[model samples]
Target: MNTRSFSFRLLAWYTCLLTCIFVLLCALLYLDLSRFLEHNVEQSQVRRAHQITDTFLATIGKTGPSYVAGQAKALYEPEISDRFVRITQANGPIIYASGMPKDGSFDPAEVPAFPPVSSRESFHRVKLSNGKTLVIAALNYHGPGKTSYVVESGALLDPAELNHLVLQLLIGLPVAVVIITVGGYILVRRALTPVERITRAAEQITQHNLSERLPVSRTGDELERLSISLNRMIARLDDAFQNSKRFVADASHELRTPLTILRGELETLIENARLDPEVRERATSMFEETVRLTRIVEQLFTLSRLDAGEAQAEWSRFDLAGLAKTTAEQMSLLAEDKNITIACDAGQAVVVEGDAARLKQVVVNLLDNAIKYTQSGGAVQLHVRRANGHAILEVEDNGVGIPSEALPHVFERFYRVDQIRSGEFEGAGLGLSIAKSICSAHGAEIEATSVPRKGSCFRVTLPLSKN
Candidate 1:
């Protein structure tokens, strides 16, 4: 469960995007509700003002100012109470007031001065210290004796509808988000299920199992298309690997018998008393080359079997230290020609279960490489020890060490470093690759480390035997 995995990261992105969208939608809803409430409240107040002004003007000249006021109050007082109402003289004296402070007064400055409304009253919202919201309107009103007055109407904001909108937002937003997020994760997981299956199948494949193909999906979507492509690639790789194994086996079998006969004939010819000295020397050189070719062919055959999983390890519990010492003693004779020192540290008996002959090949190859690369007067050391229940076999050389770039590919088949490829060194470059294959077949690991002009070290780790 990695929190930083692709699935979790995608979910995080979805959540952030959804949250922003949710907030925007919620804000838009709130604004629309506020606007609807304010407009409805203002329009209701304006209509009430029209009724009060018309009734007052109609009765004003037929009766007295006091009479008109009392009649206007009687007819429109109920309507005026729900919303606050006020009437004022042109000089700004309050003539009538209701649903406001009992003093029957409002601040004249609070009234917005707009051109007298011929058809509609101009409205504005005012906030009072008491935490009440009111929509106030000012309209022109004609009174008795050519006197004019301003009729101002106030309406309380409709809170019931706005509160409903608030409740909907508070309750619905979280529920919607939860539902959408859960659904998004499920959808994403379903979408990635093929990838997970592909990964699991790929993990099960190895060199021995290259023939296995990934399960191809038929959904015809991108994932399905990817699966088909990978299956085709794996099929091609399996074919190539099989062809390589077959070629090695076939070539090795074909060349070894002829080379054996050639060697025998050369040996016979060189031994003849009648042979010319110069011709004998040439035959000797040819014999040496034939021997090298035979060795390379045999190595290639062994590797082919290893790759095809036909080479079975003959496990035995043997003294690994003894094996190391014996291999070093044999390699020392080769080292002597270059005047290099070969030191062995195998005083302890570290026993391990493996094919002794194959393990011997591993040691021989490492020592061979060390001796070949080390300069005259250089040193090669072989140490066999048990560490953490495993046998550690180390071969170190003080020679022209591998360059940093060449170290990694030293064990790869036929991979010669640039210097070696320049004809300064003699090898087909199959020795380390063969050694690595042998180690792997025995369930062991071989690793190399080096520095330019410093030296190279090879370590082989094998599991210690219980016997």
Candidate 2:
């Protein structure tokens, strides 16, 4: 499935390298072997020619030149030898011709004007008019009474041996390549087995399992070093996660008690009969501020619980569509003040299993956001339906739309994009964060999509009750 994984890439590179090395080695071997075989043929031709000349010189005092030519002719054997031997005098008279071309294009009276021997013999490749190739070796021999004769021998350069070598390469190369490639793949897979284990272990590690560490190998190689580094990183993450949990717990305990006492004192002061109207009004304002602070603290507490996995959903079968409609009805009064229409489409009964109170809170928060952001006379629509065995809730408003850059962080805790409009819409930005936490606790998903100046839509999807 992961074609570009490290093992696959390594195997591919190994295959390519193997192919290059084999091809280069094969090319070098073929060239060397061909040269060696050609050299042997040339040497054999030179040796045979010299032997014939030596025999001719040894018998010169006993026999005539015609008799020596007759003796040389007797040595011709066409069946096993590829060489054609010929003896000729210096005056261009052919004395003997062995295995002459059947095409009769050769002129025996005119011996091939081969260059005189520079070393022991001279060799040249010659092509006959009949399209036959041969290597010709010539040796000019000096005999008795200052007489000279040329001993010339020819061997045909048949391509049978080269063809056999090419055939072996063509058949053997692919088999060798296949074997090497498979072996390379096996080696690469074995080498990366530890990485696979690390991958599976890493996948199982969520925030809930930050204490888990990747398995380390003792091979003292790169993989071992990688595992060690990864374990260190995981340990750091676990420490950070624990610290965050502790801070959240400590902050909740430190802040809530003071805010509650302040709100209670403000209530008692406002209720005093001796309190002046201005003093009572100030107390009321302080109470409101205390209440706002308490709500923000509670929201932060909820998010921390969600992150720490301390919150559990109280699952119950309920009509999700009915829940959306009730939330819309409660928020419709605020929409009315802005002359905006709040349309509820919770006409269908989509039964789902989730915490009813948390689900209701999600719908309420979404409707509240939609109503708050929508302009006067703009419309907000709440739609709930059962599609594909899931409950779908959508809240769409045609107001000043969210900017694209701010969309992704809209649900992050205390992240507000419309900083300039905070004066008018004043609050700690925890509504969306709380909604997202509740959704996740219910095994549901919530997503928002928006375009600048074109409004936004928040969609929540919850699974239907199995019953």
RMSD of each: 5.8, 5.0
Tens digits of lDDT, candidate 1, 286-388: 9999988988888888888778664456767899999999988988888999999899999999999878888898899999889888889999999999999
lDDT of 2 at 92: 61
| Worst window of 10 by summed lDDT in candidate 1 | 99-108
Score every model by TM-score.
0.75, 0.76
Clashing pairs in 1: none
RMSD (Cα, Å) of candidate 2?
5.0
Model 2 gets an lDDT of 0.81
Residue ranges of candidate 2 with Cα displaced over 4 Å? 1-16, 43-60, 74-100, 103-152, 163-221, 270-286, 329-343, 376-379, 451-455
- Runs in model 1 with CA error above 4 Å? 1-20, 43-64, 68-106, 109-152, 156-206, 215-221, 420-422, 451-454
For model 2, how does the per-residue alpha-carbon lDDT over 178-269 read when each residue is reduced to its tens digit?
A: 99889998998887788999989989997768998999889999989998999899999999989988798679768988888888989999
**lDDT (0-100) at residue 369 of candidate 1?**
88
Residue 307 of candidate 1: its Cα lDDT?
80
